[model samples]
Structures are given as structure tokens and as C-alpha cells.
Target: MAVTDPVDIRLLAALADLGKTAVHELAAKVGMDPREVAYRLVALSGSGLPLLVGVESDPQGLRAAIAGAPPSWANRPPQQQFPAPQQFAPPSHPVPQQPAPPMPPGPGPQGVPSGPYNVQGAPSGPYTVQGAPSGPYTVQGTPSGRYPGPPPRPQFAPPPVPIDPAVSTWGLPQTASWARGDEPARPAATGKRGKLGEVMETQGLEGEQLSVQLLEVQDPADYLFGAAGYRLEAGERAVVVHTEITNRGSIPFASLPDNYLELLAADGTAIGKAPVSLTSRPPHKIGVKPGETLGGHTVYVLPDATRVVSVRWSPRPEPDERTLTWSIED
Candidate 1:
């Protein structure tokens, strides 16, 4: 049967050009898989095409197959390709050497030696020649001409030892052992906490001006939001803190202020504001332009007995240990 498939025809045409090429290489040339190309080649050979004629293990016959001509001289049969061996004539006799031209006379006095003379003309012993090293032969050494090995390595002093940190004044102080009643006193509180409904102006660590006014602190029993599908857990009350912030800085404030607000307990531990309360005005992700006032409320779910004394506000979500805080009391 005739090769009817287009892929088969393309494979046969490519094989005619690149005779006995590897399956992967031919696949890359025709943009097909190697196995698919191999299958198509088998089908085309089984078909009524003389594509294998004049083809050899070597792929050099592709040009002849593509042009519909016989293999070239190199691929022809050995007997018809190369001529018969014939005897060669013996080499001729070597050519005679010509004599070299003589050198001109030296330009020196009759008694003086010149023009690359040997040391035999001089009384040798320990005398050194002008254009040569100071050695018996032309070797690199003292006049005795005995070469020594490389020079000795240099010696370096050891480094000084480092001091211990415990005894060093610049390091941390040693911990003092205290009795049960003699425990170290806690550090005195730094800044005073502000009360509700009080407006305070504070500058952040980044030099941004912020004027905050705490409106109210609401402790609701069973906070519910039917529209956003959120409810307070059992024995958990929602502590909502309402505040208004005015961007008094020269640049616009682009951060979420709610992420920086926290509620601190009596034991110096801080609790983040809860995101479950959806029924609040001015969403937590609040941004304000220069000289513009933006107000928002943040809610937190705390245990019924947990006492939240103050609300802390900072400019960053995760502030460093030395970061400043504005404590607004409830």
C-alpha cells in the first residue's frame, strides 16, 4: 500500500535527506516524538517505497537518496572505487652539501682577544667573566656553583587570647542570687496612660505626627453580627475600643492602624485585637491623608474574668523591644 499519512510522508522525506539518523534527532528536526517518528518510519518502509535502497549503516548516503542518484565515490564498492596497487621507483641519491661563507676579520688590536673567545685564553681560578654570572659554570649560585634548596619559612607570633564576657564591664552583668523576699523590684513605669475621651498628640519613631482621641470602650455581652456571620464564643466577651485618628504629618498615612493597636492586661502581657466583629464602622484597614481625620473601632475577644486596663497603640505591627507605646486607659 502507498504511504497515505502526512506524518509518514514527512518522515520518509526527512529520512531521504538524513539517512539512518537517530530517532531522537529526526524527531527534533520534524518536531515530533522519537517513538512516533520511529513508528512512522517502520510503516513507510513496510509501504511500497524503495527508501532503504543504497542506504548504509553510515548516514552519508542521504544526499544521494534525496537527489535520486547512486552513492558517491567514497561510498562505492572497494574494487570499483580504488585503483590497483603499482610498484614505486627507488628514491634518488642525496644532494651534495654546499660550503658555508667565511666570516670577516675582527675589528680589534693584534694582541687582544675578541669575538666570543673561550676561558682557556685567561688564567681562570676564581675570576668571573664580564657578561656572565659569578659561578664556575653558568649556574645560579655562589662561585662554587653548588645550588642549595629554597630558603627557610618566616616565623610569626601567636595571636592574643580574648577576654571572658562575664568579667568584662561592657558585657551583661552577672545575675545576683536573691532570697524569696528579696526578689529584684520591677522597673518603674515610664509614661502615664491616658483616659477615655481624651485626645493626645504623639510623634511616632519615624517622625510621623498622629493625634488620637479615644471615644469609648464597650464590653458587650454576646456580641452578634447576623449579616457577616460572626458570633462571640461562650464565656468570651468582646472588648471594643473606639478611636479617631487625624493624620497631622506632612505625608499621607498608608498603614493599617488596627494592626498596631493592642490591649494590655494587668500582668504586662499584651493581647491582639480580634477580627470577628464585622458590624463596626470605618473598617480596621484605615488609611488617612495629610491633615485628614479617620475614625475606626477594633474588637477583641477576652475571657469574662480578664481585666484589660489599658489600650496600647504603636506605628508598627511588630515593634522592637525599645519601641514607644501610647497607653490609653479604659
Candidate 2:
């Protein structure tokens, strides 16, 4: 029959271009795991496609296969052994001789014996060299070929500046209204839980005030699934949750407000939202500007038997005290 899956089609196309290749090589070309590629090729062949998947032994790997075996010479007979090549003595040659010259020396330049010395000028003693500076030098203050004294050390350390608890350590304040010891303390995240339809005030990582409200929850939302041309497995069902978020502080909430919204099952399991979207229901946009409110619907697909007890929202991947949860009633 015909190949419909995009991945299979791509793999077949790459195979056609390559004519014949190993499974790993084909996988590298199509960006798939070698095991997966081999499985797919076998499956396609079983489907009556003209494909063959098999492995072959490498002839060049015979040595590796027989590793730890005795050396070839160990099994050879004495009569079959080859003799070592003979060594010949090199021919001798007479080197030329020369007459020696007379010597007349006590001390050479710099008062050093007529031998190698590291000093440039006359040496005062074993460790001291004449015409050289005696002290350390600063990098920028010293001139070329001249040494200067060590850099001056500060007399005392500067006084420590007091840290304001209200100021954020991330960076400078975003707005002029935010000043040290002037802005009110942030509200504690304790007791942030509420029921559906109740407005919950929360803060983002950047301390942006936000008002989040769970507007609606539609369980077993099969109509949205069928309308959006999507299908669910036999035992799975879809859910749609409506939420509204309003930015109350001067800073903008740049993250998707409902990105972490999940359905908490009665057994303490968290069902995350599906990646699919419904055309009729708008998904949460990227950012919510200051003083602006936006409403969006989040969709989830879970087992039909799961009893969703509450809807939870978090600014991060994991839930924390800052996370807001709204209870769902049967």
C-alpha cells in the first residue's frame, strides 16, 4: 500500500537517494535513531514494500573478532620460520686533525670569567647585577627598561553599604516609582488557594502583580475535539478550561499566564495540557501588557476515568507556594 506517515516517507526518500546503506547511516541522514530506523524498515518490508533490512559481517574486522588469540609465529614450525636479516659493519673513515691555539684571558666583559654568564653589565656579587633596578614595578606607571617601586596599598577598606530588603538583587528597578525603602513589601504567597470563579492575586518572578480567575471548566469536551478535526484514543477524553489574566503592576507579564495550568486528579496525579489547540477557543498569547486583561482557553486530554479535583496554575514548570489552585466541584 502507500506510505502515509511523514517520517516513513522521509526515510524511504533518503533510502532511494542512497540506493543501499547501513541502518545507522540512513538514520544519520534522516535524523532518527538507528534502532528506530531498523524497526521501521522491517515494518515497511512486512507491509509488502520493496525494502530489505539486514546486517552483514565486516571482513576487515577479522582481527578484532579473533582478539586474544596466539600470535602467528607461535604456531609456526622451525623449518617454516624465516631467518633474521644479517647485519653488516659500517665502513670506517679517518677524521681530519687540526692544531690548537694559545689562550690569554683572566676576566672578559662584565668582569665575568671568559665563559657564559647571564648578567648583561658588571656583576656586583653572585645575585646582584650592576646598573639594574632593585625594587618591583607597577605595570602602567613604569617606563620601558626602568623599574619602579611597588604599587601603593589602600590604607583601609571602604565602609560596607547597607542592603535594602525591598530591592531586588536581579538588577536595577524597572520604573522610577520603585525606590529603596519606598515601595511596600511584597504580599506573602501563603493561602493563595481559591475556588473556581474567584479572582486570585499573584506575583510573577519579576514581582509583577497579576489577577487570575478561572472562568469555566468543561469536562469531556468532545465537541471541541471533533470540531478541531482531532481524535482521542478509545479510553481518553478532552477538557477545556477558560481563564482570564490581568496585569495589575507597572511591569508586563511576559510569560504565557496559563502555560503551567494543569488538572489535578483525585489520586494526586497532575494531568498536563495537550499541545493541540482548538480553533474556536483562543489559546493564551505570549505576553499581557500592564493594565490589560486577556482571556484564553487551555485544552487537556486525559483518561476518561480520571476525576479532576482541582485546576492548578504555576509560573514555573514545577508547583510551589506561588502556584494558585482553584477547586472543582462535581
Over 1-330, each residue of candidate 2 has an lDDT whose tens digit, in order, gives: 989999999889878755576676566556577779889999999999988887654222323324433567434543344443344544444434543232234232333323223323333333433543443222333334432332343223223344434333333222122322434535445337899899998887678899999999999899898899999999999999999999999988876677678899999998878878899998988689999999999999999999999999876544556789999884
Per residue, candidate 1 scores C-alpha lDDT tens digits across 42-121 of: 66666766744321121222222333433473344344534534435545544345442432244333332223333333
Clashing pairs in 2: none
Per-candidate local distance difference test: 0.55, 0.70
User: How high a TM-score does candidate 1 get?
Assistant: 0.40
Clashes of each: 0, 0
Q: Give the TM-score comparing model 2 with the true structure, all chains together.
A: 0.44
Give each model a TM-score: 0.40, 0.44
Clashing pairs in 1: none
Q: List ranges where model 2 is wrong by over 4 Å.
A: 1-191
Worst 10 residues of 2 by lDDT: 171-180
